[model samples]
Target: MSMTNRLKVDRRDGKLVMAHFYVAFISLAIGGLAGLLQVLVRSGMFVLPAGIGYYQLLTLHGVVLALVLTTYFIMGFQIAAVSRTSGTLTSKQRKIGWTGFVIMTIGTILAAVMILLNEATVLYTFYAPLQAHSIFYIGLTLVIVGSWLGSAVILLKYRQWRKENHKQTSPLITFMAVVNSIMWIVATIGVAATVLLQLLPWSLGLVETINVGVSRTLFWYFGHPLVYFWLLPAYMAWYVIIPKIIGAKIFSDSLARFSFILFLLFSIPVGFHHQLMEPGIDASWKFIQVVLTFLVIIPSLMTAFSLFATFESYGRSKGAKGLFGWFKKLPWKDARFVVPFIGMVAFIPGGAGGIINASNQMNQVVHNTIWVTGHFHLTVATAVLLTFFGISYWLIPHLTGRTLTKAMNNLAITQGILWAVGMTFMSGAMHAAGLLGAPRRSSFSEYGGASIAAEWIPYQVAQAVGGSILFLSIILMLYIIINLAFFAPKGEQDFPIGEIAETAEKTPKILENWKIWIGITVLLILFAYTIPFIDMFHHAPPGSKGYKLW
Candidate 1:
């Protein structure tokens, strides 16, 4: 068995992975604090002291948690998974890994420092016309560029593995990492183009005006896939790690690979669904992209089905009977299983909400409302973020040469429960207020004491209540992580990677054909966006100069 399959990452490699978790955990602390402040301000029950601006906090929270935390964690997690499943990186590959880590850390610090100075108030979306400082844009560009460098390490390692083991399947976790890396490289081209060509020039004052429609077009093009970038890693945990934690096998390796392929093919071409309400784009193109957007539901549902199967199969093997009895057979006491399980259950509703947002008519109802905010909170915050926490519970200890003691496991479970409870209060209120016409991205207001505005106040307070609980959870999370990293008893905690079940069919060779998959992914992107991309220039109104309202 490989060293990784034997439940330990090489010590040299562990340091690299630990570096990433450090940044990710720090981001959680900074971002989580900003989030609490935002909620408090929105509730109209508190006021900012001195010169602190609401949008500044909003920008900090969005960029740090959404972009910084997710990217660092994913990159680190993928690197470690690839190293474990494939083999420890060679000295050259390890050097490349450290290089990427350095560049990414530099970029993160630059961007974060700018935000702290209040020079950049643009939120995570980086939407145009709401301009931030040139350094901020440059910093973010470096962040993207640094990630590309990190992705290169994964590709190089995978290529090396392929050369060494001809006619053999790649390790499952390593293969999934490659798929995600390829998708990210392809998807970020849109954002990179806009940043290097348009936004950078404009923000630097070399250009007087910026094209809003075209910029937004490029952003959402990258934006929607950006969602999957965050999601696919969580899916990785669900498909590979969760089953192992429960002592079950993967229901089907082929199903898992196919689902990931479907994600790569269908995820990028559907960004137009986000632009349905915007003008200057043809309705026909929007309709096409919307249809493509719905196609994404297939792989998502496949994942759901596969997880259910894994659970059911394991339960049956353990003597579970009746239709729903299998659910009772899961390891409820295991923090590794239970923490991610909450995230899985949260995705059911989180995903349904996504389908609604994609529908054109439905998009109009929720677009830019607190409903949209609420929707993502459930999806990314509860569904995605909580799972990251769960992964950390095991991963941090695993890398640090320690084990999860029962007391710490209990605390980890409490952290997840707190997150769920907090999100319910916060996101549920935001959804309700949104349906009643509360706009998002605005500070507390009675709108000249308007009757309609009065109705949203209660919901705002509820969000504050939830936000407070979430902050408490964050504190607990950090404490638990510190313990795991430094104070845990010296022992081995298994790095769980699920094995394929005996009855599973052989994975078809076609699934690994990168030429065919990338060819299709590229073609679909062109089909969905080529015309709109060109037409945006022709149909766009005059561009606007940068604004700094904050």
Candidate 2:
């Protein structure tokens, strides 16, 4: 094959793969720096000035990673998987794929521009009554447009292959891509509705006002599932890649399928759980959202059990004796193993925090406090970040034909552990401080109470330190990825062992059995949601003067 032909090998092994790894590092660096700035300013650090810098950085840290990195990286992986699993992509589809990348990149730049200017400093939720510049909304829309286009290409190519080869089932990874894309399509609906009907009008001054409560409700519709949108990729890593990395076949493919199903069904209905503290919403609705929060636990536990069992199988196969002995037998040296291992550690504490926040009663204590921030940092910064880093390590070598040094991989593992541990201590301290009534979103001292002031000092300082360590760790990660991507020696490398041999049998008839699952999820969400809204109608909103918007 000519070099150009090889470049278009329709396989996951080429420049496109390397590009994905490099992109992950860049996004992580941007996001991590944003994260550090958030902590430093929130810590009341003397060096950090008060005002726009703090909020701008916080919003950038979030919007950049959550909006740009998550979608872009997921699409890259999805594209690669579709091509490999389908055996090839048509020439037109590859062009669409790159086009999506360009659009997303431009959208991300627009967002960052707005954020740095402090014009889009609404902290990503962009909750109602807090509007950013018009460009922010436009930037966000462009991002959605790009992602949707990518999804179309992936599904279309998959369809083309299935039509050509009538004797095939979509492989597990390909199925995951289709399912997640549908999830995104469903997830984006609320944001799309709100932006078009509410935010866009408000931004353009076409409307003097909009309903705060209603707008908030709409945002959460996308807001919470957005986490799953951020998360499903990490979970995907856990389900498909981790077991293979650890030297075991998937414990149960059916169980893995079910976890994705749970993600689809339960992820959306629970958005109101984020609103537990807000008034004007009925307690009954909050209660239901809380229940769905627990519903999320079922799938999470299934994942934990399945992943652990896979490791157990691998351990036994490698001649290790006894239960839990697999930890020692595992290939700690492999980049794939490192990513999922840290992910597992972060998942335990992060998942627990999620459950706590999901509870209506507990949420009242932690809501709008530093504790809430801590909980998410544990999950997003810790768990999701690890998955991103791990995949880079695994893919970069094959994509770039460069051997990522073992020393650097080990450095990554150590850094990951410190990052997790640091986040835990800081977040735990925040939770304790929150119960002590340290209010969130304040930029002042304890308003003349020394005792309260004294209590906050320690936790704030700890967060700063934790944030600092995490920040440095992110820099190290960037160095590692950059070295591998551009500077490392280039030579052919094989894909990780134990990848499911691509074959006709793995593909499924329906890449996205859209009607059945999507329909069920919509209905379940409606059933779970309507009662809350109905009850709220009879009750009154707190602090609302007949639905004031201005």
Best by TM-score: 1
lDDT for each of the candidates?
A: 0.88, 0.71
Q: Model 1, 191-211: lDDT tens per residue?
A: 988888888888888887767
Model 1 steric clash total: 0
Which tens-of-lDDT digit does each residue in 20-110 have in candidate 2? 4456557777888767766676566644455556557767777777676777777777676566555566667766766776787777788
In model 1, the worst 10-residue window by lDDT is 541-550
**lDDT for position 14 in model 1:** 83
Task: State the lDDT at 150 in candidate 2.
Answer: 80
Sequence-dependent TM-score of model 1: 0.97
- True-structure RMSD for candidate 2: 3.9
